[model samples]
Target: MKLALRKIRLVVHLLYGMWVVATRFARVTAQQRLELNRAWSLRFLQLAGMRLVVHNDGARIDEGALVVSNHISWIDIYVINAWRPTRFVSKAEVRKWPVVGWLAEQLGTVFLQREKRSDAKRIMHELSEHLVAGHVICVFPEGTTTDGRELLPFHANLFQAAVSASRPVQPVCIYYEDAHGNQSTAPSYIDEMSLGESLDTLLRGTPLTAHVYVCDALAPGAERRALAADAQVAIEGALDRLRPVGARVRQAAARGQAEQDAEVPHAGDTPAANGPLAQ
Candidate 1:
């Protein structure tokens, strides 16, 4: 059974990856891209031996909005892609990663430098502009891969810019668990693994699962700091739903209020929420 599943997974990976590239050539509009994502992603999940629990409320994700989610395994990219027509905002260095990085660029991901404050400002400015023009940009607040179990404090800087953009902000939760429902402990990218080692690990006898919870979207005009804190709270809330055994509702409430009172000093009476509200 294990060998057969691994073989099936490899074939599906190739086919879906090809489909992603092929769709780009079709000059499909963003909506089309999103629709195709749902189909292809569901297929990938089935073949990869993953069961997906996507909690969405028909949230109307606005164009040019910023959606922040937690990062777990590299598969998070493909998994998220299945659900939306959003561009990923990742570290600039990811451009150098081998196969996956290549795909990210093809999908129009935005790259930002972490330590280069000035460059980061420029990237954020560009991101803001994109959102203004009506684009959905997705970012990982934790800034790195994790075991998909704990919440990482977010950097408020980027959230600040999203505030000025006046678009709805989304918080998404993600978790990857093994065959028996054990949260994956081997998927983090903290230590580099050779190509063969990684593939072998993925093909191991157990299949994993990915659960994504799309929480309420925040409206515009939140003060930068407040938005940052609120965003963290929203994401943590989504994660807690998946592991009710250790849910921390108070922690989420506190995180939600972190930067709220700060006020949107730079924001004028904002326009109506554009894409998806608290999507």
Candidate 2:
């Protein structure tokens, strides 16, 4: 019954979000839009029963930063927005994803068609312009979501926008954990999962805690591939630190050691009468 009510509230909240973006998004200033985006995202996470914990160890650049992150769940977009509302560079397919597509469009997401060279150039130009105008733009350079265990290689094409605009590339790492503090895959939106299925899984797995680590920024003007490589390394390191050592593995190792120790006779132990030497 509690879960049902939570799902109902989430639906209503999503509808309310659609209405706000449809009705009032056009009337608001850029700053107002960002604040509204952040507030709405924070509320959505709260209603979805997920808590966000942010660790900003790097220099804070409120604007003009090309924020890059490793993608895991669709929730990642809102997670970052809950911290600092920034425009996103998403795949063109996302621009057609029912209500989500509309929201992304109205909320200033720049969509890219990955296979088209012309579209790539156009979107890159647009991203550079946004960064140069002091707007924070974020991209999931991995091009797709993962299980949050490891980072895929980052695509270097988008990193060129930061270089062209001379803006710092801020790499943010995010992963989820359960109440027991073990790294959780509950929030992962990978595989052939539909949006409805993903939402159901997320809502069912309540009380997830999302960790966002904003690592030190890689400076601009570096080679794009090099920048992407460095960002991948940074995020990989962050994920390694975030995930705990598995209890099962530790237990297995301990049991194996004990079995090996038992096989060897101790200094005070006498050999068995039926042992090979006794014969």
Candidate 3:
């Protein structure tokens, strides 16, 4: 019953939020739009029953910078937006999503079709233009969502834009945790789960807490692949440090189990302990 009420409230809030953006987005200056975006993003996070926690290692660059992060869930977009209203580079398919797509468009997301190799060069040019114009651009170089337990390889093509524009690259890391501060999969939009299904899971689960860690910015001038590698290493290191104790324990247990299984002989193979060669 409580979950149902929360869902109803969120639905109404989303409708009203969209109306607010549609009506006022045009009349505002770029800075004003950024402020509005952050405000709306915060409210959306509240409605979704999520709290954001940020840890900044250095000053956040507002202009002519590229922010890169690991993609974990759909909510990562909003979580970062709430912190700073930077334009995001998202997959083309998100542009077709109903209300969420409309909101993303309003928030100035650049949609790229991953299936087309040509899109990469076009997107790199677009991102370079945005950076040169002093707009902070955020991209999830992983190009997709993950379960929050590990980091995927980041696509290096986008970093070329930052390098070309000579913009500083900031690496941010996000993790979703439960009320007890343990890593939680409740917010992950993985596999065949639809947006509605992911939202329902979030609404029914415990309140989520997002941990956003801002690492040191990498200076420009290196090649794209080098920058991508450095950012990935920084983010992966952050994840290792900030990931919940429970998640770490589970990972360790899984490793131990795999090792134990490997030690056991196959049905047709002689056991290590009993084989004639064991002597």
> How many clashes does each candidate structure show, in the order listed?
12, 0, 0
Of the candidates numbered 1 and 3, which has the greater lDDT value?
3
Each prediction's TM-score versus the true structure: 0.76, 0.84, 0.87
Give the runs in model 3 whose Cα sits over 4 Å from its true position.
Answer: 245-279
Pairs in clash, predicted candidate 2: none
lDDT of candidates 1 onward, in order: 0.72, 0.87, 0.87
Q: Which candidate tops TM-score?
A: 3
Q: Over the stretch 138-220, how does candidate 1's per-residue lDDT look in tens digits?
A: 88877777666677788777786587688888888887767765566554554576545655565562477777788788888
Better of 2 and 3 by TM-score: 3
Worst 10 residues of 3 by lDDT: 270-279
Off by over 4 Å in 1: 1-26, 60-62, 192-199, 244-279
lDDT of 2 by residue, 118-237 (tens): 898899899999999999999999989988877888999999999999999999899898888887777889899988788888877768998898888998879899999999998887
Lowest-lDDT window of 10 residues in candidate 2?
243-252
How much does each candidate deviate from the true structure in C-alpha RMSD? 13.2, 7.1, 3.1
TM accuracy, model 2:
0.84
Return the lDDT, model 1, position 16. 62
lDDT of 3 by residue, 50-131 (tens): 8888887456888899999998788888899888889999999898987888888877789999899989889999999999
- Backbone clash pairs for candidate 3 read none
